[model samples]
Target: MTKELKESDPGSPSPNVLRIILALRKWGWGSFWSQLVLAIIASIILIATIPFVTRAAAPNPNVPIATAPSPGIGMGILFTVIGIGIVYFTAFWSFRYTKLAQKLRGANGGERPSKLQTVKLLKTGAIFSLIGMPVTLIGANAIVGALTIKSLTPQPTGGYVGVISVQPIDMFVVQASILTILAHFVSLFASLWLLNRVSDKPTN
Candidate 1:
């Protein structure tokens, strides 16, 4: 009796292609969700920290200028740094699927990923990371800008201005910043999902 040919069978498909498919299927979902949860938790904590940060950084009307960074400002900075770090960490974790592919090919015995595969995976995560990075920085800056506004010298006016001192422009910036940060997170998720899907495919 003749044996049935399989898409996974030796001589039926490229051996490396079969290994990559197996590795991606094994690692994709678990790797994605774990990192995703971490990113979300970190982001929420960072968001929660914002109010305290803005309150702390609120400039005193009496002070001519900010003498030094406020504690809240420092904490905000720390959180922003952490958020960015988490993004990079997640991207790197997603990138690990490639390694799993190599291992599936028995790289433990010294096999290597095809140059094309390696380059493709590397580019996917990297491009997303680069794309999100600017938005992250912008969001961080917006929060800092909003918090520091209290320090600005109030503009002299003949007529009474609104009681609320926070400028509409500042609030707009902050709102936009929130969207930008969320966009970065969503983009990161999409990038990881794409990496998983793309790596599993038999195509180049």
Candidate 2:
């Protein structure tokens, strides 16, 4: 019956088009959900980090805490925040593929995108993921490197509790950055795979 319908209806999608549609739906939704979950988890971790990160290093102002975090740590937080925003965008972009699939499957020719448009759309998503990869990496490196350094060379605090130690906040930033990296990776992989599927040669 499926074959008969295809044979009878010249407007039915070609094999390649069907395959592309399938790829879009499968990887698209899968990537979106995974990215979203990771992003949400990462966001929560970042939020949980605030108290630990902002805690006073010493009870008395005279005993002194560093006036500010090192450049690496500060930059890490900045980039991580930016990367999270990008992850959010990529998550939605992942969802765009499923919507594109729906459009491809519609009967209205006007609603269907040209092949070039579709490929361009996939490329845009791929490029965004590419951008996100570096951003998240920078954040991960900065945060982890700074945290490791602080852990190894803890400040002299005369054995004061909570005095400029890295342990309290290290895991929080590290975990969040790691999740963001994984989410970006998922977005990139799905975009590239779907891009390949859509770029394949069509069969009659």
In order, candidate lDDTs are 0.50, 0.77
Question: How close is every model to the real structure, measured as TM-score?
Answer: 0.38, 0.82
Encode model 1's per-residue lDDT on 86-128: one tens digit a residue: 5646546564764656454543566555646654764565476
**lDDT computed for candidate 1:** 0.50
lDDT of 2: 0.77
Model 2 misplaced stretches (Cα beyond 4 Å):
1-10, 56-72, 107-109, 157-165
Candidate 1: where are CA atoms >4 Å away? 1-12, 59-118, 123-204
Top-TM-score candidate index: 2
Error of 1 at 24 (Å): 2.4
The TM-score that candidate 1 achieves is 0.38
